[model samples]
Every structure is written in C-alpha cells, then in structure tokens.
Target: MTLIYQAGQAQQTGQIVPQLFVSIQQPSQVALNGVSTQRIGIVGTASWGPVNTPVGLSDIAGYRSSFGEKQDGDADMGVAVSVAQLQGANDFRCVRVTDGTDVAATGTLSGVTFTAVYTGTTGNALTVSLSQIGTSSNWQLTTSHAVLGSRAYSGANWSSLQAEVSADGSAFIAVTLPAVAPALATGTVTLSGGTNGGAQTSVQFVGSDDSDARTGMYALRNQGCAIGFIHGLTDTTLAGVIGTFGMSEGIYMIASGPSGDTISNAIALSASVGYKSYGLKMMFGDWLYYDDDTLDTVLISPQSFVAGRLATLAPSESSLNKQIAGIDGSQKAGLVSTGSSKTYSSAELTELFTAGIDVVCNPVPGGSYWAVRGGYNTSLNTQTWGDEYTRLTNYIAESLAGGMGAYIGEPINGTLFGDVRASILGLLSDMRGAGYLDNTGTTVPYTVVCDTSNNPQSRTAIGYLQADVQVEYMGINRFFNINLQGGAGVSVTVSNG
Candidate 1:
C-alpha cells in the first residue's frame, strides 16, 4: 500500500513542463582533498569552558609518519640526561681581556685552560719510591724482586713514588704489582726502628693449605709456639761409640768378634775328614788363645735321658732257679750224674721204699744201681721214709692217688711253676746213682709213667718219704729227692745216655 507523508516532511512538487527539469540534492558527504580546514584543539576549555575536540589522532584530519626524527637520546632506546649532567654545568666563569678595541678575526679569543691549585698535606709520611722494571709492560712490587735502598724516613717526597695518596691516607689499601710492573725498580718501602723494626723479632708464616698440613720452617715456628713442638734429640755424645760399634734394632751394640776373626754365627773347630790340625790357633767371641781356647762350648744331656742310653746292655736277675727245686722227676736210686751241670747246678736225689714197683722211667742215667729199700718200723715213726713210702704205695695201690704218687717241695716265692716241677723231679733222679744207700743198690726200673693228679694226700706222703731219704744221706751228699711211686705196675725202664 502506498503511504502518505505529512506536509512538511514530503517532497515539494515542481511544474510538469518536461524541459528535463530535475530537483538538485546535496550529496550525503562531500569528497574533498588536500589540507582540511579544521582547528586543532583539546576537548577541555582553556580555563573554564566546554570541550569541543579530543587531543588524539582521530580528532586531527591528516597525519604522516617520519623515520629520521628522534627523542632526547641517541638511536639507542635508553633514558637520557640523568641528574649527573647538572654537576659541572656552570661551574666556571670567564672574564674577557681585550685591547679596548674589537679584534675582528680572533676566533672566540683563542682557547682556554682551566687550572685549580689544591693545598692539602702529602698523604703518606713515609712514601714508597717506585720505578719500572722487567721486560714486560707492567710493574712488580714484590719484596723478592724489589731492589732495596739504604735510608728512607719521614717527610720523604712521595711524588717520585708510583702513585700518590693523602696524609690521612688509609685509602691506599694495596697496590697490585703486575709481572711487568715498572714501579719499585730501584726503591723500596722499608720498615725500620718501630714495634716491628730494627733488630726486631723474626717474622713467621702460618700454614696455608690446611690446619694439619706441613709448612715452611717459619710457619712451624710461628704457629707452633704455644704448642710445645719439640724436635727429636740426636745423641752426638755416643756418635763415636756408634761409629766403633755396629747397629742392631737401632741400638749400637758391641761387635760380636774382633778384627779378622769374626764369623756371623758361632762356629766349632771340626777336623777335616782327611786332615788333622796339629795344635790350632784359636779365637772366640773376642777371646784369643794359642792351641787351647778357654771359651769353648760344651754339650750336656739330662740324667733320665742318659740312663736310657744304657738300658739295652744291662741284664735282669732270673727267678727260674727256685722253680727247679720243688719236684722229683726220676726214681732210680743210686749215685749217678744227670742234667746239664751248667743249668742244674746241684745234685738231684732219687729214693724208693718197700712198696716200690719193679719198673720205672728215667730220662738221663749213668747206669743201674736201684736206690731202693724195704723196712717195717713200728711206733708210728712219722719221720720214717719207709713208712711214708709205704703209705704212698697204699694210696697208689688203691688208685686213690691216681695211678701215680708224687712228692713236691715247699715252693720258694716268685718261682715259676714249670721250673719248680722239673727241678724237683731232676733232683730225685740224681740221687738214684749217688751210692747214697751206704751200700750200692740196684736201680729198680719203673717204666710206668703215670699222672699224679695234684692230689695233696699222695703228694704229702711221697714228699715226706723223699725228705727222710735225703736226710739219711745228708752226710754223703747234700742232695734232695722227689719220690714218686706206682703200685705193682711193671715195664722196662729206659734212660737218655
């Protein structure tokens, strides 16, 4: 739908004569160029007024950038002109001197020289005179390398020194002397006649590396003062003695031997296998001798050990003799010889009585003389050899004494059983041929060898009979007999010739 406009807001209508008539309209914006007609001003009033423009690039009409222009400093973007530049700004003023007329061509009165005289005391009372030295382009102030001068005292001019300082001069703390330093080439800052000068105590150096580290002699003297560091004492007094003697375990001891006669160990004089020494000259442990040396070593052994050396040679006493004395080994009654005389020293006796058998056994014999007897004696003569023999026969006859009867002796103590039994038998056999009967008797051969069973009853009777027979012939020969009997048993008797 078409809308109608209000009266003042609508467009004005012109004559419709078609002479190409058109109403003109101003553009929404004018297209202008070059400098604009605009006042550059701030938005706030001058003293008290309303604002019109903002002080910024957007409020200005045209602007261009340039690169060459800079601020207050060099091209470097650092802060410029600190407070120090104001120090000497107007520090001095000049009074112009002219010839009372203008000189036309004098370019700003030539040039100017600024001089200020200072009136202060010389800094160091005693100055160090220094000079250049060495091939390098530097200076050295070392005491080891510094050249020394005779006398330097108070009021000495320090101007000739390497560098100057003030009278209250604590400022010159130290001066570095380079390897090529030219100062102190011919002068030195010496110490004299003060707390630390002129016949003063020596200076010392403390250890530098560590507390326990070893240092120079000066360091030891200074640091070890209260430490009581003592040095080892040498024995000069005994030095001569030490020279004469030899050393062992750090001790000087007298030498073991003298001159050319010394040997490392003790030596004995031994004869060579094929050579002999005819009276030797001798030297021992500092002792000298001709032929016989008093200083000789003797070897000895203990008593018990010495006794053991003789053990194999000595012989022991024998107990075999007592055993040979106890028993009868034979029954031939006569004077006869038997056994080894060297072995069985005494005569052995043989006796027989009425109950005697007709045959017997003999081991060794001289021949036949029967040591036999027969008798009847009353009154109970217990001392009767015949009666005792008869009793032995009775026991034998009854076979109560086994088949044989034996008489054995009272044995000596410590006697061996074998020798006692054999000797007793040997004794009785010896009596068989001893002619002990006071009349020679024919030997009755008893071939019956029988066992006497250690029967005490038969052995007593036989032993008694042998004792009586021995007693009866005691005057003829001091012989002993051990009689044995067999009852009525018959056989041929034999002997070892």
Candidate 2:
C-alpha cells in the first residue's frame, strides 16, 4: 500500500515503498462580504448589567431587558438607545460603566436567599413569594418586578425549585436554596439595599485599552462597530482619546458640546482640544429636545441622533440633508423652555463650520427640515471633511483587511500576486457597482497593483509581498448655484436641429 503525506509534511527523498504526497492550496479568487456600517457602539452608565463588557442589542426592548429602564439623566445607556432608535438604528454594542460602589439587592425567605443578578437600584424592585400549589405537597415560587413582570415555577422540593427557575433563563434575580429543605410557607419579601453607585467620570467612559482586560470604549474593539458615542458626555478634553480610538478601529465617533452653548465657546473648546481627525465628528451645542415616555420632554445631547442618522445611511451617503426623526425641537430652534427660538446667523454658522463643528438646524440646503447643517468631520483638510469620505474609506479598508487574510501562509509566487490582485479588484468592482466609488471623469474609479512591478526581488527574496490600492470616493453636493438672466435685458438664441 502507498503512504500518503499531507501538505508541508516531510518525506524521504529515496523510499523503497511507494509514497504519495498532496499539497493543498487556497483558491486564487476570494469572495468578500462588505462589513456592516450600521452597528453603533454606546458607552455610558447604566442602572444594571455587566460593567465594561460589550453587549449586543437589537432594539430598545432588548436594551431595557439587559440594562434596565432609562434613568433621570443623560448618562443612561437606555436613554441613548431610545434616542438612537428613532433614526432607525437597531444594531448596537453597548458597554456599561460604574463608579465602583454598586450593590446587589437581596432578600431571604425562610431558609432560602434570593439576590438580584445585577447591582443597581432597579434590582430593589424585585419581590419573591412562595406558596403551596393546590393542596399538593409541591410548592410554587413566584418572582415579580415592575418591569420584568412575573414568573412562576413549581417543584416538589427546594433543589428542584432552584433548578426550574435557573433553567428558565431568569433575567432579574438569582435563587439560592438551603442545604436542607425547610417547611414551606406563604409569604412575599421585597429586595432592598441595591445601589447604582456614583456617576461615572469621563475617564471611566473612555476606559482602558488593555487587551486581556478591556474596559469601557475599548471593550468594543474588534466588535464590528462602525459608529460610536458616549451618551451625554460633553467634555472636550477627551476628544483626542476617542478620536484616536476611532481612527485606529475604523469607527466614526460622534461627540457634542454642552446644551445651549454659545458658538464662540464651541469654537474655543475645539481649538483647545486641537484634534483634527477624519474619524470624529464634533457637534455644536444645539441639544435636541425629545419627548420620552417616562421623562416627558427632555433635552439630550445631539451625539446619539447624529450617530444614528449616520448609521442608517449607506457608507457613500451623507447626513447633511437627511431629516432627523423623533425630534420635538432643539435648543436653537422651535419651542425652547427658557426662551424663544433663536436662529443662527450666517456669520455664526460660518464660524462653527470653519472650526470643524456641525449643528442640527432647520432650513437645510434642501428645505425647511431639521438636518445636519454641514456634512463634515473634525478634519481640517477639506479633502476628508465630508462624512462619506470617512465612512467609505473605513468600509473599504476593513473589508479588504478582513478578506485578504486568506492569502497568508501560501506560496509566495506569481500565483500569490495574481490572487492578491484578483481579490482586491473584485472588492473594488463590487464597491463601484454599489455606488461607493465613482468618477465623473473618463478615468476608472480605482486601481490595484500587486504584481512584480511593485514587489521587487529585493523584497520578495526576504518573504515580503505587497499590494497597493487606491480608490476614488464619491463626493457630496455641498454647494449649488444657479445663474439667471432677465427676460427683458437678455437676448435668447434659438437652436434648430
């Protein structure tokens, strides 16, 4: 019988016995799926749930089930999710932060102890009851909460009761049974002593970048988040931190100043930060006034709305003329709590735009609708200012990075070079077909070089291969002008075919 050897296995040059060897290679052509541009990351304080761990949520209901209801302030993660959902952003990665003083609510009944699964004031609302079931020896354990509703479990003994409740995927409380079963009684007990801890600082929201123990915003690294924001955080000092993270992770971050802030102050704050990055968008302090189910009318930072609007758009599209949903009003326009609506002057807008700041205002270039005034990021260079530039660039770069890894560990030869070029060309063609890369001129929208022309012998001899790619991103229509001539003063020329 012949012996078979797999790829990369060593075999004797001269063997008396017949032998067969097989070398497997990946396909030359690779297919790549574009990464999602709608996953928004949120880092903020919450009343419940794990701290510094990224949790994926689809809707406001999922957010509430994991993080509890919205608190009475801007730092709440549920509040951010609620506002972001208005713009049709359903995919989310949320990370909760705390001040290191939270405590879980607990209560004891007979010999059983029940504790809240998460540490927060919301857990204090949990109530537990035990009673006999219909004259039978089997007992029923019921747990109720204001938001989580009620659940009942029946078992013959304490051990069985714990197993039943645990198997049902309880979200609110954890049940502990005594070693020995006690006489069952009918009574209800409310959990208490749960604390939400102190308010988190800006640094806590930024978190650490340690790979082994990621926290806060860093916890969302490699989580496929395209856009991100820290709910209600207006501190400009940390703008560089978030901007750097966005640039490194390919996440477009949205940040805002305090509500009702002056234009001059906004400009000054941005100048002080001195951060000019294509990955971040800084909003002027025109906080949005939105109606909440529990808080009625509340003023919130514009970061969530901006992030959501961008998330809902295609990578090639801009948020400039898109109307923001769920906005009752804003600090600068419509009905204000303290004063009448204040419209920004043309000069004031110029100053804000010049300083790389954007605002939500009415009378957009299209019409009288609330939209992003300027489609810009914090980039001082005009080339990268438009939101489309940041998003499209990130999208293409990430897609290539994720798909090109298949070529690694393969033989470095002409076939490898052709494979690399083909993979890149395929993705670029798909992007162009999807309307992301376009050029009005006669030239093609993209170019890829992975052949021996760029990869010289000096480099390839040392186990090095390179591929260079360039893409022309579509531009946004920022300005439109029309020239008119009066009928009486101008002479018209008629053309005949």
Candidate 3:
C-alpha cells in the first residue's frame, strides 16, 4: 500500500520548505498491529437460542440476548460467561446447540392451535390467552412470552387453524376457546407430549453439518478469531475435535477437566491428539463460587478464565498467578480442591504443571480471584512450550507473514531474501526491547535462519518460503536455594547456592 500527497501550494522560488503542515508518516518500527491473542469462543447448549452458530457478544446482556436469557438447564454457561466478563474479557463468541427433536408447547382456539416458536424448555412457561377481540367469533390469542405474540382469528371451531402454526409458548397455561358464537370464556391449557429428546453428546458438539448451520464446533469455522476456550466439552471429545477437526489460523483451544476427570486422563487426551501441534491447553479443576444465596460446591470450568486472563494481559506477560475476577473475593470460593477429597500435594502440582494442565492456588495477598497456574502448555514434554512463548512465536510468524507480503510472487532474489531477513531481525530487536526476547546486547535469544544455504534454487522453485524461528521464552523458577554463612563475630551472611 502506497500513499501520495498533493497538498502543498506552489511556493515562490525555493521558499522555506514548510514542514508541509502535515503528519509525517514514518515507517513504523514498532509493529503497528500484532496477531490478536484475545478473541475467545465457547460451544454449548443454551436454555434458548439458535443452534451451532458463532455469536460474538459484548457482555452478559448481549450473551443472554443471543442465547436466550440464562435460566434453568443453562448448565455452567452462565457462570462461565459471568466469570469471563469479570476477567475483563469483552470480546467473546458463543455456540448454542440443542436437540433437534425437542418440541414446544401449543395453544388452541376455534380449531386454530399456535405452537411454541422454538424448541426449548424455556417455552414451557408461556401463557397464551384466547379472548374475543370485540363481540364476535373473531378471537385474539395473546402469548405472555415474546417468543410468541398475539394472533387474531375468526373461526367457529378450535381446530379451524388446522395448519399448525408454531407461534410460541411458556409454562403458563393456555386459555381454551369458548364454544359460543360470541362470548368470552378462558381456560388454562397445557400442551402435552413435549419432550426435549436428550443432552448433546460429544459427537453432536462437533457438528460438521453446516447445511442448516448447526454443526456444534463446525459452526465456528472461518469464525475469524482464535478460539481461546472450548468451554465445557470433555477431554476425550476435545481431543477428537482437535485430532479430527483442526483449529486453523494458529488458534489454541483451552480445555477443562471436570470433577471426575483425572490428570492422567487429561494428559492422555493431550497426547492422543498430538496436542502440541493443536495448541490445546487443559485446565484441570480450577475453583469458582457457585451459589450467591448460600454457599454450594460446583465444578466450574476454568478455560474461560484462562482465555480471559491471557486476553487481558500484555503479550509479553504471563497470565499465571492472576486472580480470577469474581471469585477472588467470594468467600465461597477456595483453591485446589478436587471431587476426590484429595488436595494436589506440592509435588503433584509440579507434575501436573509439566503435563500441560493449569492449576489454581489460594489468593495472592491482595488479589481476589484464585491464582492461575501459568495458563498455557503443549504436551507432557514440559520444556517445550509456554503460553507467552508460543504466543510470541505465533505473533512473529503472523507479523512476518504480513510484513513479507510484498515479496509473495516476486522473483526469488537476493534483495527479497535480505528484506525478509531484515524484517525478521527488526521484529526480533523490538521483541528484545519488550522483554519477549532475552538478548543482552550480546547473546541473541532467538535465531532466524533464512539464508541461501537453506533456501537454494530447488526449494525456491517449488514456491515455498520458510523461516526457522527459535525462541527461548523464560520459564518459572520453581526451585531456588540460598546458603547462610556464620562468622565467629556472630555475623551471618547469605550467599547464593
């Protein structure tokens, strides 16, 4: 993209070159835009809403609007959304899935029956009233729930509107029509035989059928955002989705292990699907406040918080030990508790940390939420991946991709290669200053290999451009030691061990 300016008036002779009184567009040294690391997504069943579609919501209200107001049968979705919002996450996407066989209730008047508009339990509360609009056979049916509305019909028999129109309904009773030619009689009616077939299985969650746009996970394809969290899907199911259906566009999928799922189970799931490549980070049993009225124990998914935390932090900082927003101060919320009544010992926490499972501990002195174990990982090979590290590499890769776009189809020449190398080095220098790289003005913490030795004629002929980036992201100091030395004068000095 190039810009040309034509705003300077013709000056007499070589007048003092006015600084153009314009904004001087300098070549950007700092990356103007970086790969977005924040956008989070979730897939699950809503009490009421469209199925298998990615809806980006602004806040709790936005979510409720798209996924129907949260209510019974919402599972942990409402809690997760609340937690996510509290964590400063304003950008999110939700996928709603429901049984296709579910049926809504219906009301009848003058042979005309109106069925619930959508299939969900929330419709069971509808109150449809059948009353004469004036003083004639012409009657009006009004529904309490907005899911349905008032309808006017003129028919002598209740079955007259035989063509069943699924208008809408609620648990409230539907008023029965009067038998007289012109009268006002109302009776509550409960449309029976409505059954929500079943809960969504793991397979159903991976909806690939985009025909009607309701393939659970598949509904988020080309969603144009990195999926920060996979929500409440099981480990095995998540593995299947990642191993089978991949998350393109360099997105990582945050997963969770509920009460029953063991750390080993989560690890096996990670290994089974080649999780390293898939960028799947599993959070094994983090804590959250369940009941607001009375304290109650419930397994709250941590993937949402993990996503929000990472999204909330600077690209160079880690989301570890960060307090979750709401639960930080909730008296009911406590740390590292498991359903097995077993607390993970210090050593066990160490093991889980290496295995790519994030854990939570008690509140940091002034913090509110439970502290997140560093919230990212790859496989069980502990040394290989870190969230911020992986994110840095991803950003650089994406940045380089756009930075090097000018040479996409140009001839493979020295100038283009040099330009690409310079761009890589320049970005690395910026990272070094930002603390993403550990270069100490001497030792380079990264290696960018793009010289002729590797990219020879044969490789370039096949239309392949490659960059080998090596980054040594800093790791947590799990162990440290100090030695104390005592002198005859009763003086003690500390020395590094």
Candidate 4:
C-alpha cells in the first residue's frame, strides 16, 4: 500500500473513479488466544536426521519420515512418542539428534562431481546417477541415501550437478558450465566413508545453544499449541535447565525423577524440595510398570504418558486421579523384580506423594492409575505443586498475551484499549463458565484492569502500555472427611432389625 504520485488536476470523472474506491474502518474481531493445554512437545535422540530442528509428528509414520526408524537402544524418542500418541497426546514436535558425518555418493562428469547432501554412516549405501541427454550437455541427475531415497533433478548444467540441500532432502543444485562440454555417461554410483557420531548427552537434549533457531524446550515457546515438552532423558543437568527455562518462558516440562534416589531424596528434600529445584513449571515422574517382554521393571519415564493424559483432559482438570495409559497396577501381579519388588502399601505411598513423588498405584488389583502427587512447589497456601494451578494460570495469562500481541503497534486510543480490555474480560468469563477459572462462592475468579489511569499520554508517547491482571487459581479437594456422632442426640436405632 505505497502512497504514490502527486496531486493531479481533475482530468476526468472516469479516470479518477478507478482510484475512488471507498475504504471502510469498522469493528473487527481480536479474539483472545487460548493456550493449548492438550499438546505435547519433545526432543530426543534418533537413528539419523538433522540435529536440533523441530519436526511436527503425529504418528509412527511421521516419525519414520522426519527421523529414520529406530534401531536397538536408539529407541528413546520412538518409544516415548508411541506411548504419548497412543495415549491421546494432541501432537509431538521432535528434534532428532544424529550427530555424525554425512556419508556421500559421488560421480564425476567432465571433471565435475556430485556429492551426498548429509554426512552419515547411513549415507554410505547411497546411489546416484546422471544421464546426459543424448550428445547434449543437458543432463538429469538423481541422488539418494541408503536410508533416504533418491532426489531427482532435470537441467542443463554444463559443469557439475549436485544434491540440493535442505532441512528435508528434496531438490538438487548444479553449477553453470561452458557452452562446449564433454559428453557424460550414465551409471549408478554408490557412496561411502561417512560416520555416525556418538550417543547424545543430557546437555544435547535440553540444550542452551544460542544460535539454534529454537533451542531445546524453547522450541515449544512460540509454537503456542504445546503446553510443554517431556525431556524424556531425566539427566539432572537437563532437568535443572528445563526447570529454569520453562517458568521463564511460560512453557511446562514433564521429567523423570532421579531413578534410584527419588525415594530417599524426595523424603529428605521435603518442604525445601521445590526450593532446591525452583519447581515452578516442572512435574517429576515416578515408577510406572514392568515390561514383561524384557522381563524387567521398565525404566522408560512416565513423562510422556502423564503429558498425554493431561492433554486429553480439560485444562482445569487435575492430573490427579487420572488413569495413566499402559501402567499395570498390581501388588504381586507376578511382575519380575529388578531390585526390591515395586510393591508398597497405601500409607507408604501417601508419604511418598506428600513428600513429592508421583507414585503409580493400583487401588484395585488390575487397575493402575497415577497418583499425580509429586511436584516442586513452595507455596503451602495452595496446591501449586499439583501442576494444575500453574497450568491454569499459565494458560490464562499466555492466552491473553497471545491475543493482545496483535494490537501492540496499533494507534493508542480509548477505543483500542477498551477493546483489548473487553477481550480479556470476555475470555476470563468464558474460562469461569468452562470451570477453568475459580468462580466458587469463596473466591474472585479474575480481574482485568486497563484504562487511562494506567496508560497516560507520557507513557503512550514512549510506546508503553500496561495492564494489571489478578487471577485466583482454583483448588482441588484432594482430601475428604466423614464422621458420625451418636452421643449428642443420645438416640440410636438398630436398622438391621
């Protein structure tokens, strides 16, 4: 919409009519963006693919396409993704890690050669072919990796033809050549001599690389749909990083507690546990089930299951009392023991839950369910550690921020500001009606304040706008009581008679 041209003399009515279109300024919708509480994001190692790039995946097919199929212990990402997706997770964004040299296949024509796009041991089996169009220098070149199939290109590159590089291998690039060129021969050429680096470390999984477009869990930040990602690999170092960044960025994280030490460590940490880990936006997991296939209590973190379960439920819903997918709750269901049997009494488990360990339990012999108890929260006034409260607040606030983000650069006026205010109030009202906000007789649900008092001329001149929001996070009744008194009335009836 560049405004061009100087004012011209009234040439003719018809000439000016083309530029006389009326412009209308009317009311428009700026709906409050609701943060998705049902989506999960994750990052883990894979067989081979680009490192540190987020790939949206919904099923095993998506995983296989973006990241190659799993092989042996290279099953971390696949296993977690399968568990989450099967359990009804909304979607997963995975960043594959195959830190290795890309193997290449090459064929020289007229002293010009084509190379493999990525360096990897998987590329060693790649085959490439280029056919000269008869006696002409115009040629068609095709290259493909052992794992990744062929990429084709049709062109007249007098000099060299190469694989076009991309996040996903698709196109090919070539160099300009001289008018007079030597005839080329067509043949299948295999590539070799590439290597896969080693296994990924915790730092690599929950990374802090400044240069990465979206580093680690931060990838979930702007994605807007993901509530958070499960690091899956429960390295304490990785946990600490996610704990710090998740709260700061308004993203959440589901991580596995320290395996053997969780029991003793959780008990010892007690009230100071959240302080020890600044447990604002992180939820820790506990023992799930034994994999009979491997004849062992599986060490696979329950993060994915919990995440998927949470995503499936209402945003206001407490993850507590929810059924975790695939967890077989049994005291002595003949599950082989890896160490001491994973059987504990309800009293013992309650202590573990209060002390901050999300123990898996089977109240009824065959029905396994997550206690959803352990979390790092210092606030004793509320069940902030339950993660439901944090999620509610984050969901509401982040949603408001997202909705209002569109209006930032608009001209500041009472109408604009009032629209923004109404949008927030309406959103919160819907939240209250949906049971996502606290509207009980006891508490105020939410308050939104934005007006001239808050936005003055001086502040507006400097491009400053402010609003104050207060929200009362709803609480869950985790404990219930029942009692009977017979002495007060001194009347007792034998109903059995």
> RMSD to native for every prediction?
67.6, 3.3, 8.6, 7.3
Q: How many clashing residue pairs, candidate 4?
A: 8
Best by lDDT: 2
In order, candidate lDDTs are 0.20, 0.86, 0.58, 0.58
lDDT of 1 by residue, 300-397 (tens): 11111111111111111111111111112221121123342111111211111111101111222322221111121111232422222222222122
TM-score of the candidate numbered 2?
A: 0.91
**Candidate 3 ranges beyond 4 A from true positions:** 1-32, 72-76, 104-118, 122-197, 209-214, 235-249, 260-278, 291-298, 328-343, 363-369, 374-378, 398-407, 418-435, 438-453, 468-472, 480-497
Q: Better model by TM-score, 1 or 2?
A: 2
Give candidate 2 misplaced runs (Cα > 4 Å): 1-26, 163-171, 177-181, 334-339, 439-442, 494-497
Ten contiguous residues minimizing lDDT sum, candidate 1: 75-84
Q: Could you tell me the TM-score of candidate 3? A: 0.67
Clashes of each: 52, 0, 21, 8
User: Which runs in model 1 stand beyond 4 Å of their true positions?
Assistant: 1-376, 379-415, 436-497
lDDT, residue 306, model 3: 70
Better of 2 and 4 by TM-score: 2
Clashes of 3: 21
Top candidate, metric TM-score: 2
